[model samples]
Target: MRLLRDLTNITFLELDVTSTKSIASAYRTVENQTGGKLHYLVNNSGAGFVMPLLDSDIEMGQHLFDVNVWGVVRVTQTFAPLLVRAKGTIVNNISTASCMGLPYQGMYCGSKAATRLMSETLALEMKPLGVAVVIVITGNIRTRYQGGSYFSSIAERIGVYARGEQGHPQMEANLYATKVVGDVLGGAEGTIWRGAQSTIVKFALAMIPTWLMNQLAVKGTGLDVMEI
Candidate 1:
């Protein structure tokens, strides 16, 4: 609220990415406000779950994908015309988890990975049309969305196996401490993965191999003890 009041140029529009009707309405508003041309379209809606894939409900995963993956596709498709009119850019906020899958965060990672791929494809398709598509793959930057059931549910499940300091050494430290700026475009081409420790972590994950990462994730989150 304070930011809204302080920012003279910023306008807040109520948008529910999961709802086509809401997106359509917001698009109309933006079109009217900008006279049918927009400079940048940013899709940042996301949801997450933090339980083992087996324990996590399929519906929960669906919901996450709805907001994180499909929502970006929806918003981008809806606004692509206006972006083309202005030769603007489309930016999707993805996550590092998309690149490096982590235990207890597979659903979120999967959804983000989907969006990341979608953005890459969109970038290629939009290039000829002069509409730049950019992806911002973020690392842990605290936000309210990080709270809620996933946190409690994950903590409880981990507590069951993480008792008495017997949990993996990784559990002793914050699971996601490396904050990163991630992908950002400079001249509307190529991807830039920035932010703190992003280079080191990216190199390590790439060199370590997928199987090793999975094993590390299982132990790190104490998911190795989960039965069935």
Candidate 2:
């Protein structure tokens, strides 16, 4: 956030996505800033973890759902009035995980999948209200999210280096995000598969059977050798 604040032309408003009051406050701020008009609402806040479903702490996992699923709903609903007035677009940053049920990532994927579906429904509803809804079905690139749920070996490797391409860890992911917003402004709609390996994952899920896909997903996440 500090980095964003350092920029010259960007206006930043702080809010807690999990807190409805905070989102409402942010909405008020944005409304005041833009004079009761908004051009875009991007639901980008999310959280995730990796653990066996049997061993997972259901209570703790609720926080993940709150941040990933409820957060998007709260932010969008709170700012919807302004959005409708502007006839704007809503862009959601979803994950390729939403389309695949990989081992040990059920809760995270569930939250994303929920948001993906919710956005689809929202697009339909928002159409009459003159607002566009777009969802970006993203895939892994590189970031500083060192995930938990007892998978430190994998978590520790995150953001250590950019596996492919010649730039910083978040370069491609950030670029994709920027592109999505511009595309929306240019009349893009529905679900967009972006980021590294997103298209491959989407196409594979389309052609592959569920059982084989599950087996491959488990192997891809290193669950084949992972101890229970």
Backbone N/Cα/C clashes per model: 0, 0
**Could you say which candidate leads in TM-score?**
2
Q: Model 1, range 1-228, lDDT digits (tens) per residue?
A: 454578778888889999999999999999999999988787867886766666678988898899999999889989988999999888777777788777667788899888889889999999898988777656544334433443453466655432423232231112332211122323544444543345555787769987877786567453565432
| Model 2 backbone overlap count | 0
Q: Best by lDDT, which number?
A: 2
Prediction 2 global C-alpha lDDT: 0.78
Instruction: Report the C-alpha lDDT of model 2 over 1-228, residue by residue, as the tens digit.
Output: 665777798987778999987888888888888999998888888887766675568976899999998899988988999999999989999998888786667888898999899999999999999999988988765665633455555533322221222232342646876767677777888988877778788889889898888887655354555543
- Candidate 1 vs. true structure, TM-score: 0.79
User: Native-vs-model 1 lDDT?
Assistant: 0.70
Model 1: per-residue Cα lDDT at residue 212? 76
Question: Model 2: which residue pairs collide?
Answer: none
What lDDT score is found at residue 90 in candidate 2? 92
